[model samples]
Target: METGIRDIVLKWTAVVVAATWIIGCGGSATKPSPPPPAFPKAPAKKPSVTSPKKATQRPYKVGRNWYQPIPHAHGFTQKGIASWYGKKFHGRKTSNGEIYNMYAVTAAHKTLPMDTWVRVKNLDNNRSIDVRINDRGPFVRGRIIDLSYSAAKRIDMVGAGTARVEIFALGAAASGEPSSKRPPAFVPVDYNKGNFTFQVGAFKERKNAERLRQALDRRYKNAHISEYDSPDGLFFRVRVGRITDLAQAEAYEQILIEDGFNQAFIVAE
Candidate 1:
């Protein structure tokens, strides 16, 4: 009798356990899984900003020829054939790596340092305009400068195709010392006094100057290489015969020219 009662108790206990499990599972299903484990949303993206590339004022090559830019534009003046380039070079990368804009008041020079501002005066009409040097070109013989379309138009040279213009470098574009009301009077370069030397060659490579210096030291007295730290890079200027007066330097320069160093020039030391 006891065993039968125990069997009935066991069945009742099983039914109760099954009902509790089913009810517990049903409650869990209705509870919604803790919102699927929420994650923090990413921050909104910001617009990207791009900066202009810095210009390099180093020596560059065109065709088989190489040209070195001048270190400074102080007391710089030149009279040359000025030509303008428009659609052909518009939106192109210039020598200094700047985008070319035909309408901008900019110009190109074969040897002038980049960012130099110069006043271009047309010799024919006496019209003048100021332009900043940002490129390098007009590589043709006898052409001194290349102007932008608008710069050439302002100087009354667009119709002429080429104009004889005198360019006087005012200063660097960043220099705000010059008066905008009146053009600054140009002071001619002094070539009389001060110690001077004959610069026979300038090379971007130090070894090239070293080889020349070694050859010069054997033949020419006081031949040495002077280093110049330009904005673009270091330059090795091969010079000879340091003199106190400009006249002696000029005399030595002629001698260097006669010795097959035709591009030799006198530079004040």
Candidate 2:
């Protein structure tokens, strides 16, 4: 009886071992899962600057000079005397970081891209030439088109400090691409900080500016005094602030003018 029982037990153990081996072989056949797919990245783009866009470039009346606002469009046209600057400022960095060479066909415009190409026509002489804008200002009011000395020579404007002429953008840049603003229009930083301000009196007198600040505070609220050194190295600016509202600011400027702050202006902070 004992011998028969032992044989049965041995057979049952062997069967159990065989079943576990078969299950292990089946698990090996099932492989591991694959990874998920990745998404693609996009291309980068440049920044855009937003300034006032006029339907027609308006004539800017600065002092006695008639400033014509160049419309911020793909092309432009206008009439003015084209002149040039050379020698004294040659090899100097223009307003847009370009070296000034009177020998090159460059122009200075109060408003235009630094590297824009425009076809200038001397209406008096019936002569026309192309130029690139690399600098700013004829600063003498009542003038239009500041040409490089070479460009002026080419268009026969060397003799006359002023002339009658017309300018039209030709949409050609040195890079072999359609014309764009010479120095690509980059955004400027916000030039404002809220604080007590002082009114600038005649720039010549420091004491006068301080006196005005004290007087402004007596008439108004929270008026403090401070002097701002200008980049031009002339004139210390006085300001009256610690106030809000555009209308209030304009009214203050009028008051200062009335009180004989002749050069008094508002500093928007």
Clashes of each: 0, 17
The segments of candidate 2 whose C-alpha lies over 4 angstroms from its true place after superposition are 1-73, 172-269
Inter-residue clash pairs, candidate 1: none
Q: List, residue by residue over 1-269, the lDDT tens digit for candidate 2.
A: 11121111121111111101011112233776454322112214312222212223223333433333333313357775455565666667666555566666778787664555678898888888777766667664345678877678777877665678988875434343333244333233222222223234334466765665566556555445444444334443444444344344445545544554423343444
Tally clashing residue pairs in candidate 1: 0
Model 1 whole-model lDDT (C-alpha atoms)? 0.64
Q: What is the lDDT of candidate 2?
A: 0.50
CA deviation > 4 Å runs, candidate 1: 1-57, 175-212, 219-222, 225-262, 265-269
Q: What is the lDDT, from 0 to 100, of the residue 97 in candidate 1? A: 63
Give the per-residue lDDT of model 1 (tens digit) for 1-269: 01121111121111111101011112357556654322223225411212224445455556544455654576668897888887666667776666776766888898777667789999999999988777887877668888988788898787667999899988653434332122354334443567655556667899998987887676656778988776557878887666676555555545544544435555555
The lDDT per prediction is 0.64, 0.50
75 Cα displacement, candidate 2 (Å) = 3.6
